[model samples]
Target: MTLETKSLSKMDFVYWTSLVSGGVAGLVVDIVLFPIDTIKTRLQSERGFIRSGGFRGIYKGLAPAAAGSAPTAALFFCTYDGLKSYLGQFCSKTQQPYVHMISAASAEIVACLIRVPVEIAKQRRQVISLRYSTSLEIWLHALKTEGIRRGLYRGFGTTVMREVPFSFIQFPLWEYFKQNWTAVTGTALTPFTVAICGAIAGGIAAGLTTPLDVAKTRIMLADENVSKLGVSRILHGIYRDQGIKGVFAGFVPRVLWITLGGAIFFGFYDLTARLLSSDQAK
Candidate 1:
């Protein structure tokens, strides 16, 4: 008996092409929506009422978010490509993932993986305090104080909780949407169509995960003694203080952000995936 690494190894034209396209999609979304994302995140995570602000206020963390996500995006697509291919090969046609959805979902998981560290840095960057001046500086401070895991990767658990299911639901949904839509319309599934699916999926995921997301934010950003506090207690505290509406605090902004970016990010991602695979075949 012998072991074969290449046999186990996964890399192909479809994967590279999808990855390239997905990577493009990621870059476009972040660049276009960086401002909105920064603000939505801030509003979502902040306490004592959501502060209304101009585009500048909302996008305060754009610089670092952009910085963080540039590398993050590349890694996201690459990981997504590999994971989707592996998953697709093993899973059935219905359960198995396609390149498009896998790309979207994998990109998101990648986003989730780095989210905490980047988020902590982003949060610190926005606040004008003695602690953090920039992403780099904030990182240094976080490294010294809370150490790597606790400070940088604050919301590690919830990140997975949100990303995996969110990606799973979304990727397949998009692929289904593209297939059904293309068949009915007898036209290629355009970028716009893909965007619509991505947006819908993003909203659904966001709505479902907001409570956990809120907890993640509070734990990371809040000064509270996170250890003594349970997620339920914190959520109840929010409900008591701000009411049920407060739980869905950043819903509106988040929906818009996801909608706009999802369209652009995923629309291009699919298109690019097609191109990449074609190039690989050549």
Candidate 2:
């Protein structure tokens, strides 16, 4: 292979490997500690968080959270890798990094398109069954009661708005930080450092996109399925009722979980993939 092609292959090898590893780790986290994710989603929805009925309420939807999240994580990384390859055709030899960024962002956007709907169902089931049973049961109930089209896919448009830019900024930023930060520290990329960078990127992206997320949650939970609720109306309602803070409810857990979880995902994935690819290239 030519030098440029070799380099691109190396980077792509790392990139794809990191993402896939991260997906598996994410699945592990979602399944093992699903209550945290369920609570995070339920709190984001604000349908009933503070009341917390009890431990039962908090852990209401564990099973479905796993089912929904594990597969989505797998699909997300897979789609991201495929799209990056497809988009690579248009990238100049000199702009591989730029192309990488674009590919990662676009992959996330497409993944979000699918994710929002499943997440709506996942979150709704988590919220409604707060007083009841397992996440798996909730999943089946949601499937039965709400069906595929309306219930599961409640906030798809708004979800797109929230996730697209979030991924756009997050993935590239983490990679940039990982390489540079390692160089600066004169050590290999540690999980803690990677986690810190991922956290920073994730926190910024999550905060930046909170307004859209707020609208998405509302649309998902609305009795009428408020896809009709324009972005302006959603913002206006939150502003009028809850004010600016209302628009950003649950910022704490959202930031912390995403950052910590993101660190584990990206750091381990990158380290493992780079090692595997280096051996393969040899």
The TM-score values for the models, in the order shown, are 0.81, 0.78
Write out the backbone clash pairs for model 1: 17-276, 39-58, 195-263
List pairs with backbone clashes in candidate 2. 64-135
TM-score of 2: 0.78
Q: Each candidate's lDDT (Cα)?
A: 0.65, 0.65
Cα RMSD (Å) between model 2 and the true structure?
A: 4.1
Q: Can you write out model 2's per-residue Cα lDDT over 177-273, one digit (the tens) per residue?
A: 7768967888776656777787788777777787777677777766654556777798888789888887876676666667666766665555655
How does residue 122 of candidate 1 score in lDDT?
Answer: 72
Candidate 1: where is the Cα deviation over 4 Å?
A: 1-10, 49-56, 97-111, 127-131
- Count of clashes, each model: 3, 1
User: After best superposition, candidate 1 residue 174: deviation in angstroms?
Assistant: 1.3
Worst 10 residues of 1 by lDDT: 47-56
- Candidate 2 has its poorest 10 consecutive residues by lDDT at 50-59
